[model samples]
Target: MTNTNFLISGKLIDIVSREIIKAELEIKEGQIVSIRKKESVPDRYILPGLVDAHMHIESSLLIPSRFANLAVQQGTLGVVTDPHEIANVLGEIGVDFMINDAKKVPIEIRFGVPSCVPATKHETSGFVLDSNIVESLLKREEVVCLAEVMDFVGVVEEDLEVLRKIRACKNLGKKVDGHAPGLKGQNLKKYVASGISADHECSNIEEALEKISLGMMIQIREGSAAKDFEALYPLFDSHPEKIMLCTDDLHPDDLIENGHINYLIKRGLKKGLDLFSLLRAATYNPIQHYGLDLGMLQLGDPADFIVIDHPESFVVEQAYRKGKCIYKDRKVLFETNNDIILNNFSRKSILLSDLQVKPQNGSLHAIVVKDGDLLTDSLLCEPKIDNGNVVSDVENDLLKIVVMSRYDNGKPVMGFAKGFGFKKGAIAESIAHDSHNIIAVGTSDEDLLHAINTLIDMKGGIVAVNNGDREAVRLEVAGLMSNKTGEDLISDYTRLRKFASGLGSSFESPFMTLAFMSLLVIPKLKLSDKGLFDVEQFKVINLFKDL
Candidate 1:
């Protein structure tokens, strides 16, 4: 410990300590060597750099390299990322890209073995990960544990491949994550019995409480699709030790503005949560849970701590990882070379003719999405037939929703959904959740066709099609992320937002709302790369016929 490079002494409070103390810290290489003298320090607050307990790097809409730059700026020295979105689109190759990019960053990025690639057997994906793939991925040094075992329905039933994957990760002595939304009673118990150790998809206080009671670490998610802050924040008062913070899926613009874990900290403080508790949930609890090597400002730990100008404002004055400053003020210093690897995965142009639906004399089943929730509201809407063709009525607020397979799966599944708030024209995106499918919502058949085709021409990304004209935004990186910075993505997103607003859509961010179309786990109904999904039943259903 004689080769210490820097001696950082400050006012330090261990997350477990009830009282603050003065400490002198010594760092050699990247690890903390010693801490002595608890009677001298005065100003700086030495705490562990934040850790995002769970997240998806793809959701940030940036490659791992750029996302790291932004995250480190927010004092995040570590994160556990599930690359399921890109893995669903590019298969093993997608996972390799993530691992490769993550290595370029100074922060510690723990890769979670994606438990569900297609997510369910009912969907079409670019590549399918069997038990063999899961086994191989776990052997990697960077792999932490099994990613959110999204197919909870399959796991409970002891589905062969699902069980095999779980056993493989467990055999390697790694943890297994859970994603059972609204699952309670015996089903919840069965789900937990499979060696799955944690959950981040909790939607309500009841669900969070139940999971925590069952010995699962609850990672309170505040992301693009699932927002559980208000309902779950109260847990900090009672179960702060067992609780953690995560941004399961944050958009690029939101990441830039609100930050990753820092935003969650600010919001929690505003709601009257104790500062130490929030810091513990964000830093100590997560690192301890994931067994990360992120060093806190303690004796014999790595010297990774942030210099906060103001703890109340949560202003991150400077961020240090391994005792080296990576981010200062609002700028980041990283040797980033985010190379784009675009695999053209768009399908042939789909038209109004492809989305045709035959007459059903009974109640027409419709997939509905709530304004601000990821879980949908399933309802019945009478089929509106105009000149022997099912049409989209903007006045009735029932615009046509379609999900098309883009994985060259031969048999493309199409389904109708309502309540997307589309007025005139249509919008299509290749950014559908889980499985990257083409989802379109439009006022007319022509506009819907135009929207889908526009997304196809761009290779991948979101597009807004109005009448015969179209605007294509390209995300040619794995069809999930762009190798662009937040400012550029925000500029592009602003255009999409303004275009959708001009078309009479009421939602604050229509593209972000539309992106969740292919998420099969969220309840009520959703269209996937495969067929119409009834999430409650956890099975594929006939779009035209009621079963």
Candidate 2:
């Protein structure tokens, strides 16, 4: 229920003043009109609703409206969302879809102009958002900043186009987020000097501290795949003001099971970090940095706040936005409208011959994936030859990985990947990072073809095929997000994950991990629709070692 004028009583957490006081707030017309100190109040705590510093809504496999429905229940009233995933597939049309869909819900969905559409030249994206298009996007009232500049090499090498995009954001007085993982010393200095303000890709304390020292805000990322909070939590005590909390890419199951920023706050409290500091990181820090128009429980601000059981428990009981109770009684009060579906999938089914790799004389250069980390390692292993072709070796845990172009009927690019631990099935998804192409990894050629064909038939979705069983979830929106409600998507995705796990793959989020396998920007090695990309070298290398 929403009332223009209402009174709420609780122990208000004054984040700015760093104190808690029993007070009764007089909310008039969706603004905190008055705050009167009370002698006693209900046994609940009122604080500013949480904000996700950085995240990709597409990664959750739900559209912005559906994502907000789940996020608001977790006390997340706002999210700094980067629409680059969709931008790569559908360009500006995809971004407009996100902004328009977000309007159907009350949650604040701040968008950023994707700085890297294709991410790198080693991959093929359906469309490119060049500097001209980027400047046009930055002019939008809804776009607050330029998304992560994954092309760090361009900035360091003084690429004119890359610098042009940065200048556009700077000239507009907007923020330019960075994405230089493992960069340090002179290169880092040069990249930061190019006007990059914040980074959420730091996986270690030293990298985060060095960037923080250079006036770059660090976002401690704890997502479905890459987790860095444990390594960077010390910043909460040392540089609380300079750090914020974010989940760069959270899967549907993770969002449903673990909660959102509220989960991070609960974890921080258990770590014995200062309550105010943790609260500030999730609330005040990102708001100030992003210049969000959210209330901090102050008079004359928007009436956006959450009611919690207590600080120690950190369990959000209710969430209110603009004086409206959006979440209460373990349910989202508002309904999501996401019936429209937009997609850009044009790939066709592949034959088993398309998956064949002629036996080479040298060892294979395989991508070695690490569980819970985006950074991958490169390994040269002996190929298992079968019927005059190099094949998947299940005993060695090395599987055949393929990246097929979704933009056209192009031949699939084949490579080898370790760490999925798939004994007998194939998982294919059109949710590959950046490009949103069809990527699959399997232990057998038949299963791999089956999984990829299923996604092709669905236009776009995730599929896990083993024996005669097939589990799938269709992502009808840009082949990156689903139009289904959060609950439906979660149920379907959970079952697909369980089916993939039953195939003998043991990764916590195999589909999410698989999605990143084609992202050329992240690190060491990756696969693209073109070929196997060596990210460290910034080039596509031959799969056969010493070829």
Q: Best-fitting candidate, measured by lDDT?
A: 2
Worst 10 residues of 2 by lDDT: 337-346
Model 1: what TM-score? 0.94
Query: After best superposition, candidate 2 residue 423: deviation in angstroms?
Result: 1.1
Backbone clashes per model, in order? Answer: 0, 0
* Model 2: CA > 4 A from native: 1-3
TM-score for all predictions?
0.94, 0.98
**Which digits, one per residue and each the tens of the lDDT, describe model 2 over residues 294-344?**
899988989999999987667789888889888898988888876877888
lDDT of 1 at 168: 95
